[model samples]
Target: MTSEAKETGSGLTAELKELCQAVSEDFAMLASLHNKEPDAELLRLLRDERFPEGLGLRLVEERGAQAVAFMQRALSALPDQMGQADLDELAADYADIYLNHGIQASPLESVWTDDENLVCQDSMFQVREWYQQHGLMSTDWRIIPDDHLVLQLQFLSHLFAAGKTMDDLREIARFMDEHLLRWLTSFAERVAGRCATPYFAGIALLTGAYSEELRELLVSILDEPRPSPEEIEDKMRPRRVEEPVEVKFMPGMGPVV
Candidate 1:
């Protein structure tokens, strides 16, 4: 790698480490929604409007709105249903969209590009190679072929949180720009449009919100500017794109000790 590329890679890796650290906290709070039954404390917290934190609460609310909007439009598109049949059919239909219908490919920049391997071409491969170089390997849950989105975010969060070198920040920023930010905004919007429940809707909104924050941080590091909340609006606009230099990983890589 060139000197500049090395610097950028290290910087970005550090940022990803930081983000990976936050994943635990973020997921801990968000996963509360999955509780099978709510007790008095949970009920009280939800009723008091104090369960979700500031940004999280806002994200949740936006998701709720998006969900309702999607459901309303979807309901309008379908033939009329009886009162009892309405919710069951809607739920079934919504589940079908994600599970049965084919989803876009993962870990492929080409999926997001109209052209062949545009931004950060083979950059993901570089990342995979980087993982091996650093003595890191994908976990059982995060297999090589296709890692889950949530796991990827969590890993990045922790990586960025612990890693603070300038070299690490740059690499992570580029990764965020070329990979995560490049597609998450549209994905979130599409998810919002498709979901029929406030629970799922909120997840979509939260995804976009987090992506915005990550993009700002990445840009700030790349340009040597301080990222602010106001700077995140730029995510909606297109900017100059960069291609990742090719890097290779040996087979049967193991996790960093």
Candidate 2:
């Protein structure tokens, strides 16, 4: 390639990578939002402070006035500071929606996909394998299943942040198509329908829309169509019977034993 052409190609790749990273950050935040109640720091980012170059701002700009207005309404609903009563109320809502023995919108991938709607099933195994292949694992996998919504989103963020090769990007594209896209829209709908709190409901709506937008961006970068949910399920089926492999710890992933 000519020097100028090479430079242009490099610029495009950098832009794509940056876009992935931005989406990753947003997913990371959203994932954290559902995993627990809004803390002081998150409330500040959502309500008090401004991030001129932040993902939320960028989403509003790209997604238009409706998005801007929706976010404004959501932010307005959040308290500037959580008092004892507010925290307890949020905790109750979190449990009713996400925990407390049985919730309306279960976060496990298997629950959304499998006929039995079980946890720690084939989906969890496949997700764990995917993480191991990429030299990663969740420290909390013992307490929570590998295919929990938060962990899956965290895995995506890790992929975008760490990926440097076309192969890496391809993996990310496959992951989104096969895993997240299959169920996230429905999950969002469930949350919208079931969650009483405006905050959680807004999170569901935002996550669903943002993930779809991110997928579209990935399709453009990949220059190909994403696989259907059925196709993904078929492809993932055989891996379930495979023997589990020993996992290795990677640097910056966590502390080694």
- How high a TM-score does candidate 1 get? 0.48
Model 2: per-residue Cα lDDT at residue 182: 78
lDDT of each: 0.45, 0.70
What are the per-residue Cα lDDT tens digits for candidate 2 across 1-257? 00111111222377666765776787777677778877666766777543212464255425433444565676677677767787677678778877763346887788887878878877788788888876677776667788888888888877776666666778788888777777888887887677767667677767777777777766767788877777887886644476766677997896453
The CA lDDT at 40 in model 1 is 38
Off by over 4 Å in 1: 1-24, 27-98, 102-110, 113-127, 140-144, 221-257
TM-score of 2: 0.78
The predictions' CA RMSDs to the true structure, in order, are 14.3, 13.3
> How far does residue 96 in candidate 1 sit from its true spot (Å)?
4.4
TM-score of each: 0.48, 0.78
Name the weakest run of 10 consecutive residues (lDDT summed) in model 1.
1-10
The candidate that achieves the highest lDDT relative to the unseen native structure = 2
Alpha-carbon deviation at 115 in model 1, angstroms: 5.8
